[model samples]
Structure formats: structure tokens, C-alpha cells
Target: MRLMTIFIALLGSVAVPGLAADVGFEEVKITNGAEPPLTAGIWYPTNAQGTSHSLGDFTQTVAPEAPIAGSRLPLVVMSHGGGGWYGSHYDTALALAHAGFVAAAVSHAGDTFDDQSRVLQLWRRPEQLHRLISYMLDEWRWHRRLDAARIGAFGFSNGGFTVLVAAGGVPDLSKIAPFCDVHADHDLCDALQHAGVERHFGSNVPASAWIHDSRIRAVVIAAPSFGFAFGRAGLSSVRTAVQIWSAADDRHQPHPYYDEPVRDDLPRAPGYHVVANAGHFDFLPPCDARLSRMRPEICNSRPGFDRATFHDQFNADVLQSLHDTLP
Candidate 1:
């Protein structure tokens, strides 16, 4: 069966121009945010030539090899941590794409580093996820490339919280008391209010849009924060299967974010994984010498953990979960 699958995959590659080569990465402009339109990188199996171009300078950095074709591929949407861009998880996206899945990493407009406006950052994430999913479904229906039946979401940190929201893990915003003092005209305060961060939906975007979206087959969260407030009621209500993976030594966010609360809640839901030695930054790309020199403090958290190995293993686990859960 494996050999037959390989043969069919090779035949499919020959039929499609860039179907069996290394993964191809392309920046797709998605109109989903308030301003500074969201941009996401689409990673998919490509032909040899397309693969070469896709790898480009990333060959030395981190690039994922292509996967065999023939089988119907799943679709995975990746959301990055707070203040992170789509490029931060580029390698992870490519890896999933090469593993016979279409992976898209979105750069939330307000949340990215380039645009540090707190207000927009908080307000736009949910909307962006909703629009992006809608767009992907439309693409699958019209382009005839993606398998709409198998779709999942994977998010890290703030993105992790967003995935919960996408999975119907709605928290009572009132529970998220301000970690700091707030003043009038403060963008952070206003943004948080607008996003219903400490509350629920104040607008027409129904909570059902996430819980009831039949297209989203599964959800995977990494080092999810704010998940504690999204109690069992919210988590248990999700129709789609869920898999959460987190690290015990995550410094940026409290370990309890995963261990005590989130993990405690998962048994009632579906699946979850906890890595012992992992850190918060393990999901991102490997830090280069330049980053170490320029921002030592940031890279110093995970002393001996190998970023490449961690991300690769994490993605592999995610793919396995998707394969088991989704169609």
C-alpha cells in the first residue's frame, strides 16, 4: 500500500506542475483586518523548479521538503503569538505543507510588531481568523485544489487564545481584569473593550460562527494563554475535536496557563499534550547568531533547547493529531 501510494503520488506530481517538488511559499494578501491588510504565507507542494524558488534564501535558514501527493490533503491555518508576524512560523508552515497539507500562517495586522498599536491589535484578531477561514473555504470551492472537508487551526500564545475563540472557547471578558492601570484615551484599554477581550461579542459576529462552523474539523493550540477563563462549558461545547500542546517551562506565560487550567479542561474536551522541557519560544524558528547578539535576553530563555528539533517535532505531532482526528 505504501509503494502504491508513492507511485500514485509521483504520477500526480507529473500531472500537476508543482505538486511533488519542495514546498512552495507565497505571500497572499488577505483582506480581513481593519487597516494594513493582513498577509499570510501559503505553503503547498510544488514542482521542482517552483520548489527551488520557494526555498530561495530560506534554504540555509529553514525550508521544508515536499510531500507525496495522490491522497487528499488537509488544510491547516496557523496563527502566530502576540506581536509576531507570519514569517515567525514560516518553517512550521512549510513543514506542514510538505507533509501533504496546505498551511497558511496569517500576520494579524494590529498584532504584528511592525504595527505596535495595541488597540487595533486586540480588536482585529478574531475578525481576521473568521475572514481567513471564510476565504479558505471559498478558495477550496472555486479553485478545486484544497480539500474543504479537512480543515484545522493551530495557534501559539495569543494566537493560541484566538484558536480557542475560533473553537468556541469563548471566555467571559469580565474575568480578564486589567493587568495594569488603564487611563482614558488609552488605546490598549479601548482596543481591549472593542475586542470584547474581557467580555463577549458586542457586535453582529455571533459566537455561533465559531462553534457552529462545520468546516473547521479540528483545532490545535500551543502554549495557550487566557485559556484558563474559557471554562469547561466553553471547551466542552466545541463540536470539532481539539488537541493542545504546551511546555512546562514556558516563561513568557505562566506554566499554569497550560498545566493546571487548560490541561485540566482538556480531558473533558478531546486531546492534549504537554512537553516537559519545552519553552514558550520552541514553536518559533531557530534563533540565528545575529539574534543572539542583538537580543540576548529574548533568546536566553530556552538555554539548551534546539529550536529546529523542537519545531520539527512539534509540527510532526500536530500532523499526526490532524491525521487521526480530521478526515
Candidate 2:
């Protein structure tokens, strides 16, 4: 991993100047289910008249409760990694909003850090994503100003896997046993081990299920989990343009066993990128001082790597990809 870091540093890639806007922010409650209302954070382009403010652990150049800047703007839905909150990619969401996109992200019911009851239920993630999309387009007050035809999804890790499923890739849960057998030390394996495979996938569970949402016109997936589960046949129905990203030094799900196989097997070639000096958690936003002190392992980076610097480039690449693919 360290060697890979040095190799990337030698490549001399640097962040470039790009588009930006004064972002607007809001917190929403989505009542799509009888269980509990879903919590989400929404970001969108606002007239440059609003003041910057902090949202919980992160501060952004966005004003709370600001009015919309433009009508019929593009929309991007975000899904966070396993055990992550909707605010996991708050920076990226803000970037999208500044780039003339309306972005919203929801906290998975039982899959978040505070709850793990339904984390083992593979279908719940995609279902929740689909529900969020439905609510955003049909019930949200700003739905009228959103361009329905130009919609995209963004995700990382397990969230990445969800976007693929929502984009029409069906995973074979039956392959879990064999995957775990080979990747015994992998994080996915350990998660299943603790959850108990039998409890997660019962006898009635089918080998394949359709979880696609036609509303999602494009997707940007990063360091997806359970990539091997989607073989060529499983991804055959996915027709949307996909932007897939992998880290050269990801060890949690790893390159070989998780993300690479998905990119390689997709029916149509995806716009793929491998960040040389990055790790599984690098796709996440750079942590604040308080967050760094609370979680050093997730906040720390390689000797010369700067997550904040890399994200500037990443945001540009993502904005361009969405514009090109969804336009």
C-alpha cells in the first residue's frame, strides 16, 4: 500500500479549478414506511445571497432553509457506506449542489451504526433507496423544480453495491458462502459471520431478485462491496452509464475480491478510476479536528496523501461525469 502511495505521488496529478456555487441545505423527514420516518439531508444550489453555516459535525458554505436557485435542475441521490449516516458524504453532496445539482441522502433504517437489525438483509438497502427516490420526486416540495429525466445516484462501499442493484444489476446471494470461504478474513465475511448467514438468508430467499429503479438515469459507484456476487449475467440488464471507482490500497473489501470484478464484468464498459494512494475509507470526506480525534483510524492518511485535496478533483470528475452521462 505504501509503495502504491509513492507511485501515485510520482504521477504528479493535481487538483484543478472548476465550477462552484453557494450551496443551500435542509434536513427532511421521509415517511415512506410504517416502521419509522427516514432522516435525510438535502443540498441544492441557492442564490448566492445566503450565509455559510455549520451542519452538525461539518461546516459548509451553505445556508440553512435557503430558497432554490434555479428550476428543473438535475438531481442526484446518495447512499452511504455500511454503518454510515446520510452525512457520511456531506462534502460531496455539497459539491453536487454547487455544481447545479440537487442531492439528497438518507440514513438506512436498520443498517446504520445505531441500528444493525436489518443490515444483514441485503434487499433492504436498495428498497430504501428506491423509496427515497420515489419520495423525492413525488412528495418533496422541491420536486416540481427537479428535472426528472436527469437523475443520478452516488454511493461508496456497500452503498456503491446498492446503486448497482438499483441500476438493474442483480446479485446472487447464494454465492456468499463460496465468497466467504475464499475471503475468510475480508470484512464482508466477518460481517456475515457475526450476523449468521442462516438468519440473513432464509430458506425462502430466492437466489436472484429484481431491485432496479428505472428513475435512476446514471450512477457513480466507489469501492463497491460483494462485487463478485454480480457476475456477467447478473449485470446484463444494467444499461445506464456507470462511473466506477476503486482504491489501489483498499484492504477492507480489497481490489481483487470486491470492486474490480464488478467493473470488469459489467455488460457495458464503465468509466473506471483507481485512486493510487487511496484506501477503502478515503472516499469519505476528510474529517474535522473533532472527528479526527474521535476516530484517528478513519481520519489518518498516507504520508503525502491529502484527502481534502483529492476530493476537490474527485468532485470535479463526478460533476463532469454526471453532466456527460445524464445530459
Candidate 3:
């Protein structure tokens, strides 16, 4: 009798979708008053028709403010890399939404494209993700349409570091100064030096402040920054399913210091991939002609590598990982 009552209540909040459904898109504000307001872009499944819209570097076709097609759907919150915004991976978010999952990405206030205030403040990113999830499950207008138990995350570069921490991995940021001291000539180290990063950047912050939320069941991290920070000890508490990607020919934060540590340290082997001849930014959505010319460093893949082709498979793989892991 009790089980039947629960089932009936679940059905009451859900709406069945027709055979044809398009992606839905909405930009929402997440403000908790403890920090700056975060502007988030959400993509989800909807029965309404959609039209093409340009969003910064990428274009998307989604039904604006369309009511969700179904109830109790899964959610995947995205975290963009340093200097990136919510639209950085619009294609991935849309793909997830089309596959019946709510995908969202937030523009990290102090570390976004126009603001580099907290670019090196790695400790802050995880809390931003934690807050985003809290809002989606407890405050979003469509909260009841989501299955709180099935939530995942996807991130790249510094954003990769964020998801790792959110999944219960504790990075020993103290390793940064020492690693950079020895490998200052490395691409990532050189860039940090150029960014005016101080050696003791995260020293004042207490260790407990590096936030983690157990709610995230799965994660996809690509070409993570500060990868050396998560040694075996740092990754000891991480219990979520993980898929980690690294660009084989990445010049920015190459092997050994970047993805290698997390790969070898995680308690269990994560689904790992090393894309041959790919660079760090290849993990992002395929760029249009204008963006390609404007930011060749991020847009261009290595010789004989096709980014558009790779992304098709990448997006498919990400969806599959979430499907396999999320209940």
C-alpha cells in the first residue's frame, strides 16, 4: 500500500513526452548571498519546438523556457575552465539534454572570460559547483522534475580540478610552488608565472574550505590543471565513478604533471583516454570559422586531427559514462 502511494505521487509530478522533442534552454541566476551571483545556462529535454540561437562562440537550437518534457530526469552540472563561460560547452550540454538529462553550466564569477580575479584560487571552484547543485535540486522552478539521486559533473582544465574536488578528492595545492619551482620552463608553469600568481596563493585559506559534495555520483574530467596536487592521499576519499581524459599532444600541461597523477592515484581506475594528436582545448565544443580564427590556440587541433569528428564521439562517450554510472 505504501509503495503504491509513492509511485502514484511520483507520476503526478511527471509529464510524458511525445515522440518528437527538442532541447530546452534557459539562463538562470543562482544567488545565495554569500558570494557573487552566478549566471547559469541550463539545457533540458522538452516537447516544444526549438530555433537556432547564437551564444558567444557557439550556436544552439533550443526551446526557450520550454516546460520540461518528462519528470524525474537526471542532471549534469558543468564547470568551465579558467576564462571560460557557461556556453563553453553548449554542444555537450545540448547533447545531454537531448538524451533526457538536464545539463547546466555556470560562469565562475571571479575566473570567467572578463574577470581573472580568482583564476589561481583553485579552492573556490568546488564550492561554486556545490552551490549550483544545491540550487538545482532545492530551488530551481523545475526542481521536482529532477531525480536528486542521479547527478553528475563535467569539467575541463581548471574546471577539471573543480569537479575532482567536488567528488571528494583533496588536492594538496602546496605542491604547486615546488612543482613550478622545478619545472618553471614547462608550459603551464610559465603561464602561471606570466599570470602574476604568487607562490603562496592558497596558503591563507583553511584546508576544510576545499569543498566537496557527495551528491555528485559521476564525473568527466579532461586535461585537468594542477593535476599533481591530487596524489594518492588526496584522491583517497573519492568514491564517485570517474572518467578522465588527456590530450596526448597537449603542450600546455603535458603528461606526468597534469593528468598522469590523477590517473595513477585514484582509488580505482577511472575510465581514462588519451586522445592522440589532440591538444587541451580539443575537449571543448567545435568552433565556428570566426572563433577558429580569433583563438587558434584553443580552436585548432593538431595536424591530421579533426575536432568536429572527435567531439561527436566525445559527446557520445560522456553520455554513455553518465548512463552507465547514474542510476
Candidate 4:
């Protein structure tokens, strides 16, 4: 009875009204040459009303297998952070879905939770995202219903780095060792301490590998990693409108080294937001009780801070940027 009561309470907590129009959900798979099949979730506008659909311990207010709403819609491609899944930002995806946009998130083949083989390989990220976009535009079932030219990207953490490359930014692996030497205490430095990144990855990547996709017209990214790698020259190449969000107290990647450089160096004026007293994980969707128990470090916030409330505004700002830029 106690367990049942707890389950009921958790259910009620996440049962809030969704934004704008109703959302439809579907699971899609894209086969990209020899790489593992890319599993993605697509959220889009739908005329059918939605009901709560439970997946594992979490639930989303969506109509599963519902028909598409309009003939052609703007597309938003999402890339999750390191060790993160595509649904890490479901609320954001839902917001885009309700706002008459088709939002799809591809699970980066070797960087996701199930696979971490290539998490340290920085170049593979943009390449994988490129293939994902190509498949979505050229081969996905809904290709005919999508407005090819009106496309944008959303990313978080390392995924943030991926979209920037997709938007024409280049990264220099040479900068990492020097950055780690100075900030050895940082999480990024500690993670690479044992990897021998210089000998293996440094010499392999070409100085001018083309990673940009002209199809992506706008981009929104949060707490991007390897910011110093882009420097000014690499970032200046990015011509698309960008919106960047930062957590005031991010411990993992931290500021100045991560989000600051992008703000200072990008030639294009970017829409920036800094959430006071919030941590890095606060940028992720609010936690349910089950998730709170499973990952308290990320689920808990400062005494007065609320992740859900912040996301309401965060989602709105992102939608406005994409709508304004992509249109």
C-alpha cells in the first residue's frame, strides 16, 4: 500500500498541462552505413488529443502512433550530452512539438548511456550528427512532410559542441592538454587524465575537416564542452543565429572555459541566458520521485530553485528563437 501511494503521488506530480498544441510520439530507426542503427524519438504536432503514456517509470502526455498534423513543418534536431539519452530534454522536445514543429533526437551511437566507446572521440560526434541529419532529410518516412530549409538544432553539454560543429564551427584538440594542465581539478581534466588523448586523437583529426551542415539555419545549445577548442577563428565561421544557456554554478564543465568563450568569441550575436544559483543538471528536465531517488545529485537543487519552473521559461525562449530565426 505504501509503494502504491508513492507511485500515485509521483504520477500526480508530473501530470501538468502541456504547452500549445497536443503532441504525437513515435520511435524511429535510421540505418547509417556500418554504424549501429540510430534509434531516435520523433515528437510532432498532432490534431488528436493526448493521454499519459508511461515509459519505464516516467510518463509523457502524448498520443502514441498518432497521424501527423500538417503537410509540412519546421524541423528541430536534438543532440544529447555525454552519457545522456535522446529524451534527456523531452520537455523541450514537447514544447517544440506543441509549437507546430517536428523535433527529433538521435542517440549518438557510441556516446550514449548504453555505449561509451567513442565518448572521448570529439570528431565522431559531428560526423554522427551529420549522418543523422542526412538520413532524416533524405530517407525518413516523414521527409515529404518536413520543410527541408527550415531546420534548427538543439544540444546540451558535449552535444552542444556537436551542433556548433554542425553550424560550421571547428574544434582544435591541441587546446585540451593545455586547458587540463591549468585546471587539473575540473571534471573534464580528470576524465582525460588517463585517456592519452594527445597521442591517439590529436594526430588523427585533420585541421580542416568539414563538419558544417548548411541545412541547419539556427541553433540552441546549453553548457557546451570544449569551448576553448573553438577559439575565435573556428567560432567566427558559424553564421547561424545561436541561443546559449548557462548554469551559474556548473561544476562539471564550469564557466569561462565552457560557455564563456563561445559568448565572447562567436562573431554572430547570440541570445544568452544565465540562470542564477542553478547547477549544470538543472538544465535537464525536472525529476520524478523515482528519478530523484536514482540520481539525487542532479535531481536536487538549491533551496529556493525549481527546475520545472525554470524549464517553462527556458522552453519558451528556445521556441521563440527557433520560430523567429527559422521562419
lDDT tens digits, residue span 199-313, model 2: 2363245645546899999999999988988899989988999999888888787768788788889888999998988888999988888899988877887778899888877
lDDT of 3 at 180: 81
Residue pairs with backbone atoms closer than 3 Å in model 1 (clashes): 18-46, 18-47, 110-121, 173-198, 173-199, 174-198
lDDT of 3 by residue, 131-159 (tens): 89999999988999899999999999989
Q: C-alpha displacement of 273 in model 3, angstroms?
A: 1.0
Against the reference, the lDDT scores of all candidates come to 0.62, 0.81, 0.84, 0.81
Better of 3 and 4 by TM-score: 3
Kindly indicate the candidate among 1 and 4 with the higher TM-score.
4
**Ten-residue stretch with the least lDDT total in model 2:** 10-19
lDDT of 4 at 94: 84
Q: Rank the candidates by TM-score, best first.
A: 3, 4, 2, 1
Tens digits of lDDT, candidate 4, 1-327:
222233234334332112234789988887767866788888987889889987544688898888778756888999999988778788888877876788999888788877888887777777778877787788877778788888999999998999999999988877777777788888888777766544235545685674788889999999998888888998888999999999999998887789999989999889999999898889888888888999898788888998877887788778778877886
Backbone clash count for every predicted candidate, in the order shown: 6, 0, 0, 0
Candidate achieving higher lDDT, 2 or 4: 4
TM-score of 4: 0.90
Number of the top-ranking candidate, with lDDT as the measure:
3
In model 2, how large is the Cα lDDT of residue 167? 94
Largest TM-score belongs to which candidate? 3
